[model samples]
Target chain A: MKSHDSHPHYWKVFATFAKNSLIRDMTFRTNFILQCVSSVGWTLMNVGFYLILFQYTDTIGADTGWDRDKFFLFLATTWFINSIVQAFFMPNAEEFSELIRTGGLDFALLKPIDTQFLISFRKVDWSSLSNFAAGLVIAAISLWNLSARETNPMVPSIYEVALYIVFVFLGIVIMYSLMICLSATSVWLGRNQTLYNFWFYITNFSRYPMEMYNRGWGKPLYGFFTFVVPVLLVVNVPARILAKPIDPRTPSEWLLVGWAFVAACTSLLISRWVFYRALASYRSASS
Target chain B: MLTAPTWMNWKLSSWIMIFRTALEERLVYRGDFALGTLMRFLPIVTQIFLWFAIFDAIESKGENPKGLIGGFQFEEIVAYYLLTMLGRAFSSMPGLASGIAKQIREGEIKKYLIQPIDLIGFLLLNRIAHKFAYYVIATGPFALVFFLCRNFFINGMPDLLVISAFAISLLMGFLIGFFLEAAIGMIGFWFLEVSSLLFVYMLFSFFLSGHMFPLTLLPDQIEAVVNFLPFKYLAYFPAAIFLEKIPPEDLPLELAVEAAWLVFFIVVCRLAYGRGVKRYSGFGG
Candidate 1:
């Protein structure tokens, strides 16, 4: 696969993997359908919870500009990014330890492919796409509502929309990097039982706007998550780009965007380094 | 009738033995418990920030700046979350449903069928032990956090009556949560996969139990609806008792309702297990 990488057939490889995943999902039709229902049900329930919350309050943050509709867009963006990550990488991370235990990693290593790509995209949870669809609908509806509001007409330009997509893509990359880093740790830990639990706890912070963490005690947390973990960038930057709750032309806003791009690149490099190091430490079961 | 006493004594002793063994097993992983508990508290950071943001947004510019939103002052809300964390420590069944489903899927559940052991009783005893160990191990972290946020409590520690009610609610919540999850797990005997159903149950419980936010923060109609649900007993009711959110006059009725829900779930769990056993098909050796 490395030898043929110059042929520019990456899309073909991804398509094959996706096809295989869809076929596997179809084999358990009822289970797949139920999973889809469950995912969508959870998303709707989340929306309902927020709806209830917003009934008593006008905005999530004071003057930070995450009003109800704009916050919905943020939540929708969270769902979108999280769904993609879960669909593509979460299941792989979950099974990483099992693969290690069974010497499946040895087989993977032998394959003529980029090990990271093979490991990350091995399983695609098609059912998670239900949440993706739900998120798109919610985001669209929220954007429409925000734009149509009489008080402030915050219709995003095409360039802003493009930047929003780019930031969202960067968010996915950062999330994927974090997941792969944890999954790689299975090489040393033998069995990382807390992988998903830790992931859930860490990513929980990212679901809310980063502005929420700009206050007194939260300022330290913001610094740590922004610099060390980089989770704050996952949802906030893209949501900010689309919502434009704060002036996008502001220096701080531009700084955040630049910082997010830097975080994405740094995280990818760090996780790749960790994966290779863990690989070096790995000993096959037979050995 | 004459042999009932001896049989009951024997069963009680066995359950005690099971509980002790489970407790011992749990203690072996105290380090993991402590770490996991501390990690779980990480979410409170986000919650604190989020609630602070909400209160800041709702701040009136002039007189009565201390106006309580959702019938809770900022400090009270923080205190409520601390109590809720303690409540969850008691009632949270992390893997109870899925564990049972896995056992059933693997045909290991046949061990209970063959033995005199009652599955639900065994599971309940194990969970009691698990919670016991968790509280013992996690108390330090809980204390540190609570001490740090001590000012959040409006009146500091509650009186004996409130504490007793809070304890009772937590116990009842544990039983309700266990039986509810066990009943869901029993569905695995009938269906090849119960994961989706379990997921739905978890989603509902997370919202309705006020694990995410105070039920009082919800709309009045929805709060009323949540009040009727057994889930509120899991995390919210115990915390509410600690906060004195429920009126003294209403305490007895609420406790009775919680007990009733526990009884209902217990019966459902038994029925499901019994019927499930009838349909059991063996799996891998």
Candidate 2:
């Protein structure tokens, strides 16, 4: 198999990967059931937290004119975006350092398909699909509640939804690239788990609306993290686009889009650079 | 059967051995140990700043909020959250149950069982040693930051006495939690998968323990129900003590309740261990 073949069918690779992952997951039915139950329990606990918070404070940021329903809808949307990332990106990122430790990357290197794509998409924890579905259902319910309460319902237009989807896709691409870059560092660090924890800790930024934070401090920091690193954009921008319609005339939305594109490009380039650099250090454990 | 004094001495020696092992193990991961401490500190700081921002916004709106959220002033809320943060740090025990489960699965615990050491004593010691270091390193800095950032004043020695009593309650709370976890770890002898059970316990601790939010913030009926639960003794009581909300005179009654729970958990652990050992096949061997 040619390692760098240009004519390789990527869809076929993905199909095989998906099928293998599904089979492996289905084999562990009891574990999957327990995980699903645990996910629902956690989601309910988290929602209860927000409900209690809103009980005391009517809006997260009252000055921003966001009410309880809007605040929760934003939280629900954030969870949805997070679930999407967890489903697609987190499993791969989590396994990277371990792969390096165990010399599992050699198998990927020997494959005809792109090593990066194979490593990132190889193991899909199908249980995360339940999380994603649950989050979307919760978001839909919250949005429905909001519409019922409002006299003139602020239902998001199709254009807004389309843009949001585009941003979410871009966000996932950037996130995957960032994970690849981070995982590539594992080749050098050699079994260090600190990076994974750091990634998880920083990802907590996406759990809430960025606007809830003081913008004076948050905006500049968000700009740096979102544009430069791109984790912040994963949920914040997508949630913003979905929660409210962006003014077409405003420079901010255009700047955000441009920034997201640049972030995606930069992440991919950096990941490629790191992966190639670390490839030299790869020594198989089998030897 | 061993005499009481001999058993006590044996337990003490085993505890020292466990502590020594943990310390050595912790030293091997010094960098991560430091980072974990810092990571643990960040959540508390973030929570404090978040509450500060909210209360600042509220006070600026010219409400004389004096009690708790529109009752007490913003300073009180800061103090409450700071104490809660400190309580959270002190109360958190490492999930050694899962670690033990893994050991059991891998046949690692069988070697330990052959040794003269008391397994429960060793496990509890390991927990206490790490917690001792963590509370001092993490909560010490947190308390310092909190005090430095605010003009906190105590009304009297009675409040200080209440806080001290709450500290004892906090210790008992940790004991209850540790024994409960030990009991759960023993369940590994029967069940191959206990992660879900552990997750349920964690969620219960986070919500019902008043770790994420104040117990008083819940509706009166809910607060009454929560008060009857053991989770409140873990965090809420300590926080109430620091805020001077719990009256100094009521300290003994609360301490008795905490002690009762500790005793109950100890009995449960003993029962679980007895039954668990009968079912224990030492599978890998």
Candidate 3:
């Protein structure tokens, strides 16, 4: 019954949700452990894949400036951002349409708390967060190796590290915005079976650096993802800020940082608008 | 319900009927199928960029490199990916295993027990029909993408032998993939939750089966290990056979090995289903 307008009440409710989620996870001890192990194993396999590719080439793309360690750092950031999104938001988006079809959202709407917050954080998939720990380990190792290297060392100052954290959070915000917007579409469609598949197809582009998308034919693709969908800014900016900080030597490079900030704000606003509009159009299912 | 026919001719006729019904079910949402298939091809865009950069880097070196890296010429690599798309079309079971596990968990599998049709055979025929429907509906998208990649066929059309080998491998790969997944789903008879297990199996299969990149790109020792594994028959072997990357002497042996794996998985699937069905309790009812 407590509203989310008050900051203290929101945090209190969130803490309870986290605690309940942890309890549920612990109730299935073996399943929890196996899920964690499986996730970590998958990450290790991905690392091995990149290691083999690095043997054949010095960088992911020609003259892209992303070397092995830096690229791993980028990959680690991807896992971290994606883990958070998946752990909290993905399951909820996947189930949103079911709630609508079954009239479960009516109960949610009756609650005094903010509807979006309740829907998004209601189910925390604790096992999905297992990849977050692996991401941290990979990020640490990549950072250590990058600093040890002779060529273009990338040791971040404390200020830069703080900026990195901020940008990473911004990246999560952008991704969450995208997800909720798609979930909102479930209201009109009545079913969103293809939402996750479409999401995966789109986000696959974010796995690689944006610079890789700047070639001849890639130019249009680069423009589309950067300006149209804006997924290109989600991971690349935060990864670059941490792994290979942009030099102030070029005005164009500075524009990229500015674009990241703009992207984050625009995505958040658009998603919020879409969610509310979808809710407004909702006609509760008959009992 | 009608009993299955004893005659060999009628047995084939019933399977054809099953296949046709399944194909009709898939075609019910033809637009969805076409759009979904096209969206999945979006990754090809990323691959083209990634490969182009790799080739550019290789070209930057002083040597001509003969259009080759990792035993695949640049055009050949693109051709290989196009072939892989076709191979995966046959072999990839997106949610088949999980769907089976869900049915077993929910006790819906009892319908299969009561039905006259063999569960494995029914599922296999249904999947064959689904793939047939997908292939027919998606041929336009496939052709469009392949047309873009036409230049990648540097050697023109391959010989009949290569094409035959490739087709055989893809068919065997589909059988292997199906049986392997159905066997995994049968694990649900013992463990109520096969989701995590399926996750592990899928993750390993995706990497080892050369879905992400060719196994040949791995180191020689690792590639040898992968070759010994059954996963390559699912994606890599068909593509390799089509490209004539496998030596002429090796073709028969590789195909034989692929067929052996198919038989192995078929046996495993039957054994698992046989044992699991006996222990399956109707939980919901």
DockQ per candidate: 0.69, 0.45, 0.66
User: Backbone collision count in every prediction?
Assistant: 0, 7, 0
Least accurate stretch of 10 residues (summed lDDT) in model 3 chain A? A245-254
lDDT of 2 at B271: 85
Two-way lDDT contest, 2 vs 3, winner: 3
Q: For every model shown, what is its TM-score relative to the native structure? A: 0.93, 0.88, 0.93
Question: Model 3, B105-200: lDDT tens per residue?
Answer: 888899888876788888888998888899999999899888887888888888998888888999998999999998988888888888988988
Model 2 spans > 4 angstroms off? A1-6, A215-220, A245-254, A280-287, B1-15, B45-82, B103-116, B133-159, B281-285
Candidate number with greatest lDDT: 1
DockQ rank order: 1, 3, 2
Can you tell me which runs of candidate 1 are displaced by over 4 Å? A4-8, B1-13, B60-64, B101-109, B274-285
Quote model 1's TM-score: 0.93
Where's the lowest-lDDT run of ten residues in candidate 1 chain B? B60-69
